[model samples]
Each structure stands twice: as structure tokens, then as C-alpha cells.
Target: MKQRHEVLFKQLESYRSYVLSVMENVTEEEAEIIPFGFKNNIRWNLGHMYLDQYLWIQAVTKEKCGVPEQFKSWFGFGTTPANFNSETPSLEELKNLLKEQPAKIKDVYGERLEEEFPPTEMGMHTIEQVLIRTIFHEGMHLQAILDLKKCIQPSF
Candidate 1:
């Protein structure tokens, strides 16, 4: 892998580690709490984090996304906890997926980061560029998670 790819993957891993660390103490019930003024809970944000990367990568690579079909309906953009069913993944499940995802992504795409795609509206034409965008998106959801955490655990 190129030095830049190594740095990008390290950034991805570090960000995911920070997210997991923040969520490590959250109980399942806490994860499910949709605090006032928030459309979704920490659980939804986590699932959205898992789903968004796959969706964006699919868009750039034109490969079929590997996540289950229900992911789109339950965790895709514009989705909320109201859309969840009994079949929705538990927080533990989502966390496990999130924990493993950076490694999985590196394994799959590490060598392909420089591969060019048609430019997105944002002019992102490489897998590396797409990964950068996803990292920013993850930060956005991380903020949402922190906000929900503070609401659910005022002392947190």
C-alpha cells in the first residue's frame, strides 16, 4: 500500500476506535433512547455509519453492497428509529460490524484507492477520495451519538 493509503486507513481506524470508546459504556436501553429533538438514537446513528460507507463505496465501485437489504430500509439516509422493526440489529451487532469494518475495508480496497471512477458531484474520482468523504460523514454521526449520549445520560 502507498504511504498515503496507510495514513488514510490509520485515520479510519483511529476514528472508529474513538467512536467505540465513547459507546463502550452505553447500555442497550441507552442506545435505543431517542432523546427529545433528535430524530434518531445512538443505535440508529451507529447503523447509519455502517451502512453509509457501503453505499458510497458501491456508488463509486459499482459493486453490489454487501450489507443486507433491510439495512437500506432501516438505516439508510432519512431513516429513523421509527422505521426499525424487531428484526433490526442489536447495538452489540452493529458495534461488532463497526469494529471490524475498517480492517475489512482496508483488506478489500487498500490496493485500489488510486483507482479512478467518474467524478462525483463533489469531484471525488478515486477510492481514496471517497474514503475521505466517508470519514467526514462518520464524524458527523459521531457528533450525533455524543449528543444523544449527553441527553440520555446527563452526567456523562
Candidate 2:
């Protein structure tokens, strides 16, 4: 039987593919365009997804953030500010990272997570619970990207 983590891994893999397909042929301007001013650009959302995963699987695990430092600020957890500078990785790089990250997590999933991730803290979840939260969060953003694409390019 597949473990819960395995199931989640598969779902995350599909979500990653969905995100990539949405942005595959996008121009830089389109990637950065924030439709309705209420949502983040696709580029920022992608980076944030990467960063959130990295923080959970790596930072929370007391391992390295596998992604480059120069691009960290753009996607680093708790770093998304309304007026923050947006730095984007090339499409090739982003696609590769999205593909690579799930494998990396699977590789390390069996290792004991050293940090104590409490279920709640001050009426909120601890970091571990937050990681699970991010999985759903990424899914929501992926859907948003699809909706945004339809809005921006109706014929697509």
C-alpha cells in the first residue's frame, strides 16, 4: 500500500506538472503581470511554491535549501511583501527545479525529521503543519494560474 507521503508526493508531482504547463510558453511580461491587482504574478507564485517546499523539506529538516541563494529572497518564506522586488528564474531553471524537488523530498522523507513540528501554537499550527498547509496553498495558486491564463488569453 502507498504511504500517505507517497500519495502526497504523487499529487504534488501532478501539481508541479500542472503549474509548468500553465507557464510553458509565457512571455516574461505575462509571467510578471498581476491581473486584477489582487493576485501575484505567475513567476512569483512559482518561486514561492519552490521556496515553500524547500523550507519544509530542507530548512525544516535542517538541510540545505538546494535552490540558489540569489533567488531566495523572491520566494523565501515570510518574505513576500507587497512592494518586494521580484526576481525570476529562467523558465528552464524553474521547470527543472519543480521536477527535481519532489524526488529530493522522496529521497529524504524516510529520514527522521529532527525538528519538533507541533500541531498548534498560539492557536496556529507549527511549522510542520504549515508545510501541509503549503501543499494545498500551491494547489490553490495553480488553479489561479489557470484561471488567470483564461482571463489573459481566452482562446488558449
Candidate 3:
């Protein structure tokens, strides 16, 4: 892997660790609360962050990345906790998936960061570009998780 790609993966791991740290003390009940003025809960943000990477990467590669089929309905853009069924993954399950994801992505795509594909509507044409976009997306959701945490535990 290139030095730049290694740096990118390190950044990815660091940000994901920050996200998981913010979530460490949250209980499942806390995760489910969609507090006033928020469209989703911490749980939805977590699930969405996990699913969005796969969706964007698959879009760029034109290949599936093993994201669970139900994730689309549960965590896709515009999806809300209201739409989630019993089939929706629990907070622990989602956390486990999120915890493993960075390493999995590194193992799977570390060498192909510069491989270009046809540009999507967003003009992303390389694995590195897609990873950058997903990192930003994760940060956005990380903010959401923080906000939800504040709302769920005023003392937080």
C-alpha cells in the first residue's frame, strides 16, 4: 500500500475510534431516543454510517460489498427509526459491525485506493475519493450522535 493510503486508513481508524468512544456509555434505550428537533436517533446515525460506506463504495466499484439487505430500509438516507422493525439490528450488533469495519476496509481495499472507476454523479472515480467522502459523511453522523447524546443525557 502507498504511504498516502496508509495515512488515510490511519485517519479513518482514528475518526471511527472517536465515534465509538462517544457511543461507549450509551445504553440501548438511550440509543433509541429521537429527541426533539432531531430526525433520527444515535442508533440510526450509527447504522447509517456503517451502511453509507458500503453504498458509496459499491456505487463506485459497481460491485456489492456485503452490506445486509435490510440496512437500506433501516438506515438509508431519509430513513427514520419509525421505519425500523424488529429486524433492525440492535445497538450492540451495529457497534460490533462498526468496530470491525475499518480494518475490514483496509484489508479489502488498501491496495486499490487509486484504482479509478467511471465517475458517479458526485464525480468520485477512485477508491480513495470514495473513502474521503465516506469519512466526511461519518463525521457528519458523528456530530449527530453527539447531539443525540446531549439530548438523551443532559448531563453528558
Candidate 4:
């Protein structure tokens, strides 16, 4: 079980690195530029990744999330661009949050595997299940960021 957790942890770390690398060269304007017909911007996508991960991992695990209330609704499962009006954190802030996530997740996993995770409208999930979904969700957005980058700054 520990070995499985380690593997999942490493996979999450790799995906985190991939996300950071994609955002490294993106300008502020580029981050906010929504591709035509797309509902959310890159900034929203990045923020959503952090918010959702924190919600599932920390909130569900009965750990301290420290998420600002103002940003909470932006991350709700059914939120769309039409309903999400908050500004995104700066690129530096987003990167810092990403940097902190792996350690936080490891610490939480170390302390609380036996406890039940919180229920959601999407239904119940084990800790491992939540982590897997979070990883997949991040990958989806990372691909979206790539697509947006290609559209906004083709020279890169």
C-alpha cells in the first residue's frame, strides 16, 4: 500500500512539473486569453486545478485547506465561465501553490488514510480515487493550456 501511494505521489509530481513548464513562458495576457468558443481561460484552468485538488485532498481528508472563500465558488464542480467571475492569482502565486501541493498531499496521506473522505455531489471516492481523478483533471487542463498556447503564441 505504501508502494502504491509512492507511485501515485510520483505521478502527481511529474504532472505538476509538466504544468509548471507549460506556464513558464506564458504571458499574463496569454493566460487570460480564452480560445474562441472555449468557456474558461488558461488562468481559470490553472486556478481550478489548484482549487479542486485542495478541495478533494485537503477538505475531504479533514485537513486545513485555508482556501479563500471568494475563490471557492470558482472551483465548484459545475461552475462555468458564465458564473465564474473572480480574478485569477498571479502566475507567481499559482506557481507557489503548485510547489506546495506535493508536500501537503504527502503529509496528509501520511496522517489520514483511515479516515473517510468527504462526500460530494459527484458521489463518494476513496483517497486514492480522488487523487487519480485530480491527476486526470490536471492533465486535461494541461492539454488545454498547450492548445491555448499554440493558438495564442505559435512561435513558441
Candidate 5:
């Protein structure tokens, strides 16, 4: 399982870069624009991924949740993009956070993959297990973001 997770962490970095590549060259307005049928925009998707990754990673491991406190209000699950305000991180900031976060995860938990879960609801036993779950979560959001881009801006 550890070996699988080690490879997964690397794959997470690659998937994150792909997500960022799909998001490049979008203006703030473009990032913020809610497509005709979508509930969230590109910016919100990026922020939510950052926030969710922090939350899930922390749930399965003992490490500190890395993002700012206000992330819960703006980017937590069930929060809407419509609520994105001045306090929301900028496009460049979000991009930077997303870029470095997977590497940070590897740094903190790479060798610690067998750590027991912290009474989490997911019934996961080890940190690597939850990290595996996160890979799928991020991939789902990546597709959602790409769908949003197709509605608002093509891949660039």
C-alpha cells in the first residue's frame, strides 16, 4: 500500500499540474464567471480543491492544516462561488498554492503513509488510504473544472 501511495503522490503532482495547465491564461473575470448552467467558477474550484485537500489530509494524518483560517468560510464544501468576495485568494495566489501543495503533501507525509486515521468518518485506516481517496476527489474536480472551462473558455 505504501508503494502504491508513493506512486500516487507523484501522480497527484502530475494531475495538479495538468489542472493548472488547463487553467492558465484565464483572467480573473474569466476565472470568476459562472457559466450559464454551472454553480461554481474556475476560481472557486481551485480554492475548494486547496481547502478540501487540506481538510482531508489533516483528517487522516496528524499534520497541521496548511491554509488560512478563512478558507473554511469561502472554500469549504457546500460553500458557493457566489459568495466569493474580496478576501478570496487571487488567481495567481490560488495557482501558487495549488502548484506547491502536492509537493508539500509529499514532504510531510511521504514516508508517514502508514499513520492511523484520526477517528475520521470515512472509515479509512491509514493516511495513505485517504490520500488515495483524495486522488479520485481531485480528479473529479479536475473534470468539473475542465467542463467549466469548456463552457466559459477552452483549454489554453
Candidate 6:
């Protein structure tokens, strides 16, 4: 089971790389643009994925948010990116943090997938299920980053 968890964690690392590639060379202004019909930009989508994943872990493990305090308000699930003016972490900073996340997850929970969590309201009883859901969530957001990239690119 731990070996399976390791594979899932590697997938998470791949997802992070996918996000970085999708966002490569994106400008802050472009990242903040709310293209027609989209709810967020590359920036918000990137940050949201991180914060949302953190929240999911918190929910499943009863652990506190390991991310910065602002993540909860600025990029937390449902936090909109439109007209954002306040100071937020730069994309590079976020990128660095994003890169560091999976290693941290593996260090902390790598061997503990069989550990039982409080029964999830959503019915996830083991760490593996919760982490698998995390991978699914990351994949969904990775696709969103691609969608946003298309929307932000100037259509000829």
C-alpha cells in the first residue's frame, strides 16, 4: 500500500510540473486577467490549487494549514481573482512553494497511508483515499490552468 502511495505521490509531483509548464512565461497582468467566461486567471487558478489541496489535507488529517496565512483568504476555494489589488505572493514564489509541496507530503505521510483518519464526512476513512482525491483534484486544476492559458492568449 505504501508503494502504491509512493506512485500516487509521484503523480502529484508530475502535476506540479504540469502546472509550471502551463504557466511558463505568464505575466502577472496576464495571470490576473479574467478572460471572458472564466472565473479566474492563471494566477488565481495556480494559487487556488495549492490552497485547495492544503485544505483538503487539513480536512482529512485534521492538520492545520501548512501554507501561508493569506492563502486561506486570497486563494482558498471560491476566492475570486477579479480585480485583485492586494499584495499576493509572486508567481515565482508560489512556484517554489508548489515545487516543495510533494516532497513535504511524502516526508510527513509517506509511510502513514494506512493511518486512519476521523471518518470523513465525505466517507474517506483512510489516508490513501484522501490523498487519491487530492491527486484527482490536482489533475482537475491542472486542466484548468491549460484552459486559462488558452483564454488569456490573444486569439488571432
Best candidate, TM-score-wise?
3
Name the runs in model 1 displaced over 4 angstroms: none
Worst 10 residues of 3 by lDDT: 143-152
Expressed as tens digits, the lDDT of each residue in 21-112 for candidate 1 is 99999999999998779899999999999999998888888888689989999999899889999999999999999999999999988999
- Taking every candidate in turn, the Cα RMSD to the unseen true structure, in Å, is 0.9, 3.9, 0.7, 2.8, 2.1, 2.1
Least lDDT summed over 10 consecutive residues: which range in candidate 5?
Answer: 147-156
**Candidate 6 residue lDDT tens string, 49-69:** 777767777778888856777
lDDT of 5 by residue, 51-141 (tens): 8877877776656776787898888888887677788898889999999998888887788778666667878767677777877888888
- Across residues 88-156, which tens digit of lDDT does each residue of candidate 3 receive? 999999999999999999999888889989999999999899999999999989988988888899999
Ranking by TM-score: 3, 1, 5, 6, 4, 2
Q: Name the weakest run of 10 consecutive residues (lDDT summed) in model 1.
A: 118-127
Note the residue pairs that clash in candidate 5: none
Prediction 4 TM-score vs. true: 0.82
* Number of backbone-clashing residue pairs for each candidate, in the order shown: 0, 0, 0, 0, 0, 0
lDDT of each: 0.93, 0.64, 0.93, 0.75, 0.81, 0.76
In model 4, how large is the Cα lDDT of residue 117?
Answer: 59
Model 6, poorest ten-residue lDDT window? 81-90
lDDT of 2 at 96: 77
